[model samples]
Target: MNATQRTNERPGIEKNRIIRIENGKKAYLPLLLLADEQEDMIDRYLERGEMFVLEDGDRALAGVVVSDEGDGVLEIKNLAVIPAHQKKGLGRRMIGFIADRYRDRFHTLLVGTGDSPMTVPFYEKCGFARSHVVKDFFLDNYDHPIIEDGVRLRDMIYFKKSI
Candidate 1:
Protein backbone atom coordinates (compact mmCIF):
# COMPACT_ATOMS: atom_id res chain seq x y z
CA MET A 1 0.00 0.00 0.00
CA ASN A 2 1.27 3.48 -0.84
CA ALA A 3 2.01 5.52 2.30
CA THR A 4 -0.04 8.46 1.09
CA GLN A 5 -3.01 6.31 0.08
CA ARG A 6 -2.89 4.28 3.31
CA THR A 7 -2.56 7.40 5.45
CA ASN A 8 -5.13 9.38 3.52
CA GLU A 9 -8.04 7.01 4.11
CA ARG A 10 -9.95 9.62 6.13
CA PRO A 11 -12.15 11.48 3.67
CA GLY A 12 -13.58 14.96 2.99
CA ILE A 13 -11.84 17.85 4.78
CA GLU A 14 -8.87 15.57 5.51
CA LYS A 15 -9.74 15.36 9.21
CA ASN A 16 -12.45 12.71 9.03
CA ARG A 17 -10.54 9.49 8.44
CA ILE A 18 -13.53 7.18 8.22
CA ILE A 19 -13.41 3.69 6.67
CA ARG A 20 -15.99 0.90 6.64
CA ILE A 21 -14.27 -2.38 7.35
CA GLU A 22 -14.79 -5.00 4.65
CA ASN A 23 -11.99 -7.38 5.74
CA GLY A 24 -9.28 -8.08 8.30
CA LYS A 25 -6.37 -6.65 6.32
CA LYS A 26 -8.16 -3.33 5.94
CA ALA A 27 -8.88 -2.99 9.65
CA TYR A 28 -5.48 -4.26 10.81
CA LEU A 29 -3.39 -1.24 9.93
CA PRO A 30 -5.71 1.20 11.67
CA LEU A 31 -6.36 -0.99 14.70
CA LEU A 32 -2.69 -1.78 15.13
CA LEU A 33 -1.99 1.89 15.65
CA LEU A 34 -4.89 2.42 18.06
CA ALA A 35 -4.79 -0.66 20.30
CA ASP A 36 -2.11 -1.11 22.94
CA GLU A 37 -1.78 -4.84 22.23
CA GLN A 38 -2.08 -4.50 18.48
CA GLU A 39 -4.78 -6.11 16.32
CA ASP A 40 -5.03 -9.45 18.11
CA MET A 41 -8.83 -9.36 18.00
CA ILE A 42 -8.91 -8.80 14.24
CA ASP A 43 -9.33 -12.46 13.20
CA ARG A 44 -12.15 -13.19 15.65
CA TYR A 45 -14.11 -10.11 14.56
CA LEU A 46 -13.34 -10.89 10.92
CA GLU A 47 -14.86 -14.34 11.45
CA ARG A 48 -18.08 -12.59 12.41
CA GLY A 49 -17.32 -9.71 10.02
CA GLU A 50 -18.75 -6.91 12.18
CA MET A 51 -16.20 -4.15 12.48
CA PHE A 52 -15.72 -0.54 11.36
CA VAL A 53 -13.10 2.23 11.57
CA LEU A 54 -12.83 6.04 11.91
CA GLU A 55 -9.85 8.18 11.21
CA ASP A 56 -8.60 11.79 10.88
CA GLY A 57 -7.27 12.47 7.43
CA ASP A 58 -4.49 9.88 7.05
CA ARG A 59 -4.28 9.17 10.78
CA ALA A 60 -6.54 6.58 12.40
CA LEU A 61 -8.08 8.62 15.26
CA ALA A 62 -10.28 6.02 16.90
CA GLY A 63 -12.17 2.73 16.49
CA VAL A 64 -15.30 1.52 18.27
CA VAL A 65 -15.33 -2.03 19.66
CA VAL A 66 -18.64 -3.84 19.42
CA SER A 67 -19.05 -7.47 20.34
CA ASP A 68 -21.91 -9.86 21.13
CA GLU A 69 -22.07 -10.25 24.90
CA GLY A 70 -25.17 -12.45 24.90
CA ASP A 71 -28.73 -11.57 25.88
CA GLY A 72 -28.71 -8.42 23.76
CA VAL A 73 -25.87 -6.73 25.63
CA LEU A 74 -23.24 -5.38 23.26
CA GLU A 75 -19.89 -4.95 24.90
CA ILE A 76 -17.73 -2.06 23.82
CA LYS A 77 -14.77 -4.40 23.54
CA ASN A 78 -11.84 -2.00 23.10
CA LEU A 79 -12.13 1.64 22.11
CA ALA A 80 -8.68 3.14 21.82
CA VAL A 81 -7.55 6.60 20.79
CA ILE A 82 -4.00 6.75 19.56
CA PRO A 83 -1.75 8.64 22.01
CA ALA A 84 -1.54 11.62 19.70
CA HIS A 85 -5.32 12.01 19.67
CA GLN A 86 -6.15 11.36 23.33
CA LYS A 87 -7.28 14.81 24.52
CA LYS A 88 -9.61 15.49 21.59
CA GLY A 89 -13.36 14.97 21.99
CA LEU A 90 -13.20 12.56 19.04
CA GLY A 91 -13.29 9.62 21.45
CA ARG A 92 -16.65 10.77 22.78
CA ARG A 93 -18.08 11.27 19.31
CA MET A 94 -16.88 7.86 18.18
CA ILE A 95 -18.34 6.31 21.32
CA GLY A 96 -21.71 7.93 20.76
CA PHE A 97 -21.72 6.64 17.22
CA ILE A 98 -20.90 3.13 18.37
CA ALA A 99 -23.51 3.11 21.11
CA ASP A 100 -26.10 4.26 18.62
CA ARG A 101 -25.64 1.01 16.70
CA TYR A 102 -27.72 -1.01 19.16
CA ARG A 103 -30.54 1.55 19.11
CA ASP A 104 -33.54 -0.18 20.69
CA ARG A 105 -32.27 -3.73 20.38
CA PHE A 106 -29.57 -3.94 23.02
CA HIS A 107 -30.44 -3.27 26.64
CA THR A 108 -27.04 -2.25 27.90
CA LEU A 109 -23.44 -1.59 26.94
CA LEU A 110 -20.49 -2.78 29.06
CA VAL A 111 -16.92 -1.54 29.06
CA GLY A 112 -13.97 -2.42 31.30
CA THR A 113 -10.81 -0.43 31.79
CA GLY A 114 -8.00 0.31 34.23
CA ASP A 115 -9.09 1.42 37.71
CA SER A 116 -6.48 4.09 38.04
CA PRO A 117 -7.49 7.62 38.98
CA MET A 118 -7.34 8.73 35.37
CA THR A 119 -9.72 6.23 33.73
CA VAL A 120 -12.61 6.33 36.22
CA PRO A 121 -13.42 9.97 35.53
CA PHE A 122 -12.96 9.58 31.81
CA TYR A 123 -15.62 6.83 31.81
CA GLU A 124 -17.81 8.91 34.07
CA LYS A 125 -17.51 11.80 31.64
CA CYS A 126 -18.54 9.37 28.93
CA GLY A 127 -21.69 8.72 31.01
CA PHE A 128 -20.52 5.41 32.46
CA ALA A 129 -20.20 4.63 36.14
CA ARG A 130 -18.54 2.17 38.45
CA SER A 131 -20.39 -1.12 38.36
CA HIS A 132 -17.68 -3.45 39.74
CA VAL A 133 -13.98 -3.97 39.97
CA VAL A 134 -11.97 -6.80 38.43
CA LYS A 135 -8.58 -7.68 39.79
CA ASP A 136 -5.47 -7.87 37.62
CA PHE A 137 -6.99 -6.47 34.45
CA PHE A 138 -3.79 -5.70 32.60
CA LEU A 139 -2.02 -8.88 33.69
CA ASP A 140 -4.86 -11.05 32.47
CA ASN A 141 -5.50 -9.37 29.11
CA TYR A 142 -2.33 -7.75 27.89
CA ASP A 143 0.56 -9.62 26.24
CA HIS A 144 3.33 -7.37 27.58
CA PRO A 145 3.94 -5.16 30.60
CA ILE A 146 1.32 -2.40 30.52
CA ILE A 147 3.24 0.41 32.19
CA GLU A 148 1.48 3.69 31.57
CA ASP A 149 3.73 6.69 32.35
CA GLY A 150 5.92 4.45 34.61
CA VAL A 151 3.14 3.14 36.79
CA ARG A 152 2.66 -0.64 37.11
CA LEU A 153 -0.86 -1.70 36.13
CA ARG A 154 -3.39 -4.15 37.54
CA ASP A 155 -7.16 -4.47 38.10
CA MET A 156 -9.95 -2.65 36.29
CA ILE A 157 -13.20 -1.01 37.19
CA TYR A 158 -16.00 -2.02 34.85
CA PHE A 159 -18.64 0.47 33.76
CA LYS A 160 -22.07 -0.02 32.23
CA LYS A 161 -24.73 2.13 30.64
CA SER A 162 -28.27 1.47 29.49
CA ILE A 163 -29.62 2.87 26.26
Candidate 2:
Protein backbone atom coordinates (compact mmCIF):
# COMPACT_ATOMS: atom_id res chain seq x y z
CA MET A 1 0.00 0.00 0.00
CA ASN A 2 1.03 3.59 -0.51
CA ALA A 3 2.23 5.75 2.40
CA THR A 4 -1.09 7.61 2.76
CA GLN A 5 -3.31 4.63 2.15
CA ARG A 6 -3.00 2.98 5.54
CA THR A 7 -3.32 6.08 7.71
CA ASN A 8 -6.68 5.58 9.28
CA GLU A 9 -6.76 1.85 9.90
CA ARG A 10 -8.39 2.25 13.30
CA PRO A 11 -10.91 4.99 12.82
CA GLY A 12 -13.17 4.60 15.83
CA ILE A 13 -10.53 4.13 18.53
CA GLU A 14 -9.41 7.74 19.06
CA LYS A 15 -9.15 10.99 17.20
CA ASN A 16 -5.43 11.08 17.84
CA ARG A 17 -4.09 8.34 15.58
CA ILE A 18 -0.54 7.18 15.11
CA ILE A 19 0.12 5.96 11.57
CA ARG A 20 3.25 4.10 10.56
CA ILE A 21 4.94 5.29 7.40
CA GLU A 22 6.79 2.65 5.40
CA ASN A 23 8.06 5.10 2.84
CA GLY A 24 8.48 8.78 1.91
CA LYS A 25 10.36 9.98 4.98
CA LYS A 26 11.14 13.26 3.29
CA ALA A 27 7.51 14.30 3.25
CA TYR A 28 7.74 14.75 7.03
CA LEU A 29 11.07 16.59 6.83
CA PRO A 30 9.87 19.87 8.29
CA LEU A 31 8.60 18.18 11.46
CA LEU A 32 11.50 15.75 11.68
CA LEU A 33 14.04 18.56 11.54
CA LEU A 34 12.43 20.13 14.55
CA ALA A 35 13.69 17.27 16.68
CA ASP A 36 17.01 16.86 14.96
CA GLU A 37 18.20 20.09 13.41
CA GLN A 38 20.59 18.78 10.76
CA GLU A 39 19.14 17.43 7.54
CA ASP A 40 22.16 15.33 6.62
CA MET A 41 22.21 13.74 10.06
CA ILE A 42 18.57 12.78 9.60
CA ASP A 43 19.36 11.34 6.18
CA ARG A 44 21.62 8.75 7.79
CA TYR A 45 18.63 7.06 9.42
CA LEU A 46 15.43 8.39 7.82
CA GLU A 47 15.10 5.93 4.95
CA ARG A 48 16.58 2.95 6.74
CA GLY A 49 14.11 3.26 9.59
CA GLU A 50 10.36 3.33 10.14
CA MET A 51 8.44 6.56 10.55
CA PHE A 52 5.21 7.32 12.39
CA VAL A 53 3.01 10.38 12.38
CA LEU A 54 0.54 11.35 15.08
CA GLU A 55 -2.57 12.86 13.62
CA ASP A 56 -5.64 14.34 15.19
CA GLY A 57 -8.42 13.84 12.70
CA ASP A 58 -7.16 15.63 9.58
CA ARG A 59 -4.29 17.46 11.25
CA ALA A 60 -0.77 16.11 11.67
CA LEU A 61 0.50 16.95 15.13
CA ALA A 62 3.76 15.02 15.54
CA GLY A 63 6.19 12.59 13.88
CA VAL A 64 8.87 10.10 14.95
CA VAL A 65 11.39 7.73 13.36
CA VAL A 66 12.73 4.54 14.94
CA SER A 67 15.44 2.24 13.72
CA ASP A 68 16.63 -1.18 14.79
CA GLU A 69 19.97 -0.41 16.40
CA GLY A 70 20.98 -4.05 16.76
CA ASP A 71 21.35 -6.14 19.94
CA GLY A 72 17.60 -6.25 20.35
CA VAL A 73 17.42 -2.49 20.77
CA LEU A 74 15.24 -0.01 18.91
CA GLU A 75 16.33 3.60 18.84
CA ILE A 76 14.10 6.60 18.31
CA LYS A 77 16.01 8.60 15.74
CA ASN A 78 13.79 11.63 15.79
CA LEU A 79 10.58 12.90 17.34
CA ALA A 80 8.89 16.25 16.81
CA VAL A 81 5.52 17.79 17.51
CA ILE A 82 4.14 20.80 15.70
CA PRO A 83 4.77 24.02 17.60
CA ALA A 84 1.07 24.72 17.96
CA HIS A 85 0.53 21.28 19.47
CA GLN A 86 3.41 21.39 21.92
CA LYS A 87 2.86 20.73 25.67
CA LYS A 88 -0.49 19.09 25.09
CA GLY A 89 0.55 15.55 26.17
CA LEU A 90 0.85 14.55 22.51
CA GLY A 91 4.58 13.82 22.72
CA ARG A 92 4.25 11.59 25.78
CA ARG A 93 1.37 9.79 24.14
CA MET A 94 3.40 9.24 21.00
CA ILE A 95 6.29 7.83 23.03
CA GLY A 96 3.93 5.50 24.83
CA PHE A 97 2.46 4.42 21.50
CA ILE A 98 5.86 3.59 20.07
CA ALA A 99 6.90 1.65 23.17
CA ASP A 100 3.75 -0.42 23.15
CA ARG A 101 3.98 -1.04 19.42
CA TYR A 102 7.57 -2.26 19.61
CA ARG A 103 7.64 -4.02 22.98
CA ASP A 104 7.25 -7.48 21.58
CA ARG A 105 9.85 -6.89 18.90
CA PHE A 106 12.58 -5.21 20.90
CA HIS A 107 13.91 -5.49 24.42
CA THR A 108 14.47 -1.80 24.95
CA LEU A 109 13.74 1.58 23.36
CA LEU A 110 16.51 4.14 23.18
CA VAL A 111 16.54 7.80 22.25
CA GLY A 112 19.62 9.98 21.79
CA THR A 113 19.16 13.70 22.16
CA GLY A 114 21.27 16.75 22.72
CA ASP A 115 22.02 18.03 26.20
CA SER A 116 19.71 20.99 26.46
CA PRO A 117 17.75 22.50 29.28
CA MET A 118 14.61 22.26 27.21
CA THR A 119 14.87 18.68 25.91
CA VAL A 120 16.55 16.64 28.66
CA PRO A 121 13.87 17.23 31.24
CA PHE A 122 11.12 16.30 28.84
CA TYR A 123 12.70 12.94 28.03
CA GLU A 124 13.31 12.26 31.69
CA LYS A 125 9.67 12.93 32.41
CA CYS A 126 8.77 10.43 29.70
CA GLY A 127 10.34 7.66 31.86
CA PHE A 128 13.69 7.58 30.14
CA ALA A 129 16.77 7.52 32.35
CA ARG A 130 20.12 8.75 31.23
CA SER A 131 22.17 5.81 29.96
CA HIS A 132 25.26 7.52 28.61
CA VAL A 133 26.69 10.59 26.96
CA VAL A 134 28.76 11.08 23.84
CA LYS A 135 31.10 13.99 24.32
CA ASP A 136 31.22 16.63 21.63
CA PHE A 137 28.68 14.71 19.62
CA PHE A 138 26.98 17.69 18.02
CA LEU A 139 30.18 19.59 17.44
CA ASP A 140 31.79 16.57 15.82
CA ASN A 141 28.87 15.22 13.81
CA TYR A 142 27.05 18.22 12.43
CA ASP A 143 28.70 20.66 10.06
CA HIS A 144 27.57 23.59 12.21
CA PRO A 145 27.14 24.01 15.93
CA ILE A 146 23.72 23.50 17.51
CA ILE A 147 22.28 25.58 20.30
CA GLU A 148 19.03 25.14 22.16
CA ASP A 149 17.48 27.19 24.93
CA GLY A 150 20.41 29.62 24.62
CA VAL A 151 22.96 26.90 25.53
CA ARG A 152 25.30 25.38 22.99
CA LEU A 153 24.73 21.68 22.54
CA ARG A 154 28.02 19.84 22.76
CA ASP A 155 27.10 16.39 24.00
CA MET A 156 24.76 13.68 22.82
CA ILE A 157 22.86 12.39 25.83
CA TYR A 158 21.34 8.98 25.46
CA PHE A 159 18.28 7.90 27.35
CA LYS A 160 16.67 4.47 27.52
CA LYS A 161 13.53 2.84 28.82
CA SER A 162 12.95 -0.86 28.96
CA ILE A 163 9.80 -2.09 27.30
Candidate 3:
Protein backbone atom coordinates (compact mmCIF):
# COMPACT_ATOMS: atom_id res chain seq x y z
CA MET A 1 0.00 0.00 0.00
CA ASN A 2 0.96 3.61 -0.47
CA ALA A 3 1.74 6.11 2.26
CA THR A 4 -1.82 7.37 2.37
CA GLN A 5 -3.43 3.95 2.64
CA ARG A 6 -4.84 3.26 6.11
CA THR A 7 -5.86 -0.11 7.50
CA ASN A 8 -9.44 -0.57 8.70
CA GLU A 9 -8.19 -2.41 11.78
CA ARG A 10 -9.16 -0.61 14.98
CA PRO A 11 -8.00 -1.52 18.47
CA GLY A 12 -11.46 -1.57 19.97
CA ILE A 13 -11.70 2.17 19.49
CA GLU A 14 -13.83 3.93 16.94
CA LYS A 15 -11.88 7.14 16.49
CA ASN A 16 -8.33 5.83 16.66
CA ARG A 17 -6.94 4.02 13.61
CA ILE A 18 -3.64 2.61 12.40
CA ILE A 19 -2.08 3.79 9.15
CA ARG A 20 0.91 2.51 7.22
CA ILE A 21 3.42 5.29 6.71
CA GLU A 22 5.17 4.41 3.48
CA ASN A 23 7.00 7.70 3.13
CA GLY A 24 8.32 10.49 5.29
CA LYS A 25 8.50 8.25 8.33
CA LYS A 26 10.98 10.60 9.92
CA ALA A 27 8.24 13.16 10.38
CA TYR A 28 7.26 11.15 13.42
CA LEU A 29 10.79 11.05 14.79
CA PRO A 30 9.83 12.68 18.04
CA LEU A 31 7.46 9.84 18.83
CA LEU A 32 9.94 7.27 17.58
CA LEU A 33 12.65 8.68 19.80
CA LEU A 34 10.58 7.84 22.82
CA ALA A 35 11.41 4.20 22.19
CA ASP A 36 14.76 4.38 20.45
CA GLU A 37 16.58 7.44 21.79
CA GLN A 38 19.31 7.95 19.21
CA GLU A 39 18.68 9.22 15.71
CA ASP A 40 21.70 7.47 14.23
CA MET A 41 20.54 4.15 15.62
CA ILE A 42 17.05 4.68 14.26
CA ASP A 43 18.52 5.44 10.85
CA ARG A 44 19.95 1.94 10.80
CA TYR A 45 16.51 0.45 10.19
CA LEU A 46 14.01 3.27 9.69
CA GLU A 47 14.29 3.44 5.92
CA ARG A 48 13.98 -0.29 5.28
CA GLY A 49 11.41 -0.90 8.00
CA GLU A 50 7.65 -0.58 7.71
CA MET A 51 6.16 2.08 9.93
CA PHE A 52 2.69 2.20 11.44
CA VAL A 53 1.14 5.01 13.39
CA LEU A 54 -1.88 5.07 15.62
CA GLU A 55 -3.78 8.26 15.10
CA ASP A 56 -6.69 10.00 16.68
CA GLY A 57 -7.80 12.20 13.87
CA ASP A 58 -4.82 14.22 12.63
CA ARG A 59 -2.82 13.79 15.85
CA ALA A 60 -0.58 10.78 16.16
CA LEU A 61 -0.89 9.05 19.51
CA ALA A 62 1.72 6.35 18.97
CA GLY A 63 3.95 4.81 16.32
CA VAL A 64 5.71 1.52 15.63
CA VAL A 65 8.32 0.43 13.11
CA VAL A 66 8.84 -3.19 12.17
CA SER A 67 11.38 -4.94 9.97
CA ASP A 68 11.56 -8.41 8.49
CA GLU A 69 14.57 -10.04 10.15
CA GLY A 70 14.45 -13.17 8.00
CA ASP A 71 13.61 -16.65 9.35
CA GLY A 72 9.97 -15.77 9.96
CA VAL A 73 10.92 -13.15 12.48
CA LEU A 74 9.52 -9.63 12.50
CA GLU A 75 11.40 -7.28 14.77
CA ILE A 76 9.86 -4.20 16.29
CA LYS A 77 12.53 -1.68 15.49
CA ASN A 78 10.80 1.01 17.43
CA LEU A 79 7.56 1.67 19.28
CA ALA A 80 6.49 4.71 21.24
CA VAL A 81 3.38 6.36 22.51
CA ILE A 82 3.08 10.02 23.36
CA PRO A 83 3.61 10.63 27.06
CA ALA A 84 0.11 11.97 27.49
CA HIS A 85 -1.42 8.87 25.92
CA GLN A 86 0.91 6.32 27.50
CA LYS A 87 -0.10 3.86 30.20
CA LYS A 88 -3.56 4.09 28.71
CA GLY A 89 -3.12 0.93 26.61
CA LEU A 90 -2.07 2.73 23.44
CA GLY A 91 1.23 0.85 23.33
CA ARG A 92 -0.49 -2.47 23.84
CA ARG A 93 -3.02 -1.59 21.20
CA MET A 94 -0.25 -0.81 18.77
CA ILE A 95 1.40 -4.16 19.49
CA GLY A 96 -1.89 -5.96 19.04
CA PHE A 97 -2.37 -4.24 15.73
CA ILE A 98 1.09 -5.30 14.59
CA ALA A 99 0.71 -8.89 15.76
CA ASP A 100 -2.68 -9.26 14.13
CA ARG A 101 -1.54 -7.63 10.90
CA TYR A 102 1.52 -9.86 10.59
CA ARG A 103 0.14 -13.07 12.05
CA ASP A 104 -0.06 -14.85 8.75
CA ARG A 105 3.20 -13.55 7.34
CA PHE A 106 5.43 -13.89 10.39
CA HIS A 107 5.74 -16.54 13.05
CA THR A 108 7.44 -14.51 15.78
CA LEU A 109 7.44 -10.90 16.91
CA LEU A 110 10.72 -9.68 18.38
CA VAL A 111 11.84 -6.55 20.20
CA GLY A 112 15.08 -5.47 21.82
CA THR A 113 14.99 -2.92 24.58
CA GLY A 114 17.05 -1.72 27.49
CA ASP A 115 16.79 -3.56 30.78
CA SER A 116 15.03 -0.68 32.41
CA PRO A 117 12.24 -0.87 34.90
CA MET A 118 10.27 1.40 32.64
CA THR A 119 10.42 -0.88 29.61
CA VAL A 120 10.97 -4.50 30.62
CA PRO A 121 7.71 -4.76 32.52
CA PHE A 122 5.83 -3.06 29.77
CA TYR A 123 6.90 -5.60 27.17
CA GLU A 124 6.19 -8.42 29.59
CA LYS A 125 2.72 -7.04 30.09
CA CYS A 126 2.31 -7.03 26.34
CA GLY A 127 2.83 -10.83 26.31
CA PHE A 128 6.52 -10.89 25.42
CA ALA A 129 8.90 -13.22 27.19
CA ARG A 130 12.55 -12.61 27.89
CA SER A 131 14.54 -14.24 25.12
CA HIS A 132 18.19 -13.22 25.21
CA VAL A 133 20.51 -10.35 25.93
CA VAL A 134 23.15 -8.60 23.96
CA LYS A 135 25.89 -7.66 26.38
CA ASP A 136 26.70 -3.97 26.79
CA PHE A 137 24.62 -3.10 23.81
CA PHE A 138 23.74 0.37 24.98
CA LEU A 139 27.25 1.17 26.10
CA ASP A 140 28.74 -0.16 22.91
CA ASN A 141 26.23 1.34 20.50
CA TYR A 142 24.87 4.61 21.82
CA ASP A 143 27.11 7.64 21.95
CA HIS A 144 26.41 8.09 25.63
CA PRO A 145 24.82 6.23 28.47
CA ILE A 146 21.09 5.66 28.34
CA ILE A 147 19.37 6.05 31.67
CA GLU A 148 15.74 5.19 32.28
CA ASP A 149 13.82 5.29 35.56
CA GLY A 150 16.98 6.31 37.39
CA VAL A 151 18.82 3.21 36.19
CA ARG A 152 21.61 3.26 33.67
CA LEU A 153 20.80 1.03 30.70
CA ARG A 154 23.47 -1.46 29.81
CA ASP A 155 22.50 -4.65 28.01
CA MET A 156 19.90 -4.94 25.32
CA ILE A 157 17.23 -7.33 26.48
CA TYR A 158 15.44 -9.09 23.71
CA PHE A 159 11.86 -10.29 23.95
CA LYS A 160 9.73 -12.42 21.68
CA LYS A 161 6.15 -13.52 21.21
CA SER A 162 4.72 -16.04 18.79
CA ILE A 163 2.58 -14.24 16.28
* Candidate 1 residue-pair clash tally: 4
Question: Per-candidate TM vs. native?
Answer: 0.74, 0.89, 0.90
Estimate, for each residue in 1-163, the C-alpha lDDT of model 3 and write its tens digit: 6544546444466577899999999999999899988999999999999999998977899999999999999999999999999899998999999999999999999999988888889999999999999999999999988989988898999999998
Number of backbone collisions per candidate, in order? 4, 0, 0
Candidate 2's C-alpha runs over 4 A off are 1-14
Candidates 1 and 2 compared: the better one by TM-score is 2
C-alpha lDDT (0 to 100) for residue 37 of candidate 2? 84
Q: Which stretches of candidate 1 lie over 4 Å from their true place?
A: 1-18, 25-33, 38-49
User: How large is the C-alpha RMSD of every model relative to the true structure?
Assistant: 5.1, 5.9, 6.9
Best by TM-score: 3
Over 76-129, each residue of candidate 2 has an lDDT whose tens digit, in order, gives 999899999999898898899998898998999899888887788989999999
- Candidate 1 global lDDT: 0.67
Query: What value does the lDDT take at residue 76 in candidate 3?
Result: 97
Candidate 3 Cα deviation (angstroms), residue 92 = 0.7
Model 1 lDDT tens row, 120-148: 67778989867888898678776777665
Q: Worst ten-residue run, lDDT, model 2?
A: 7-16
> What TM value does model 2 have?
0.89
Task: Flag clash pairs in model 3.
Answer: none
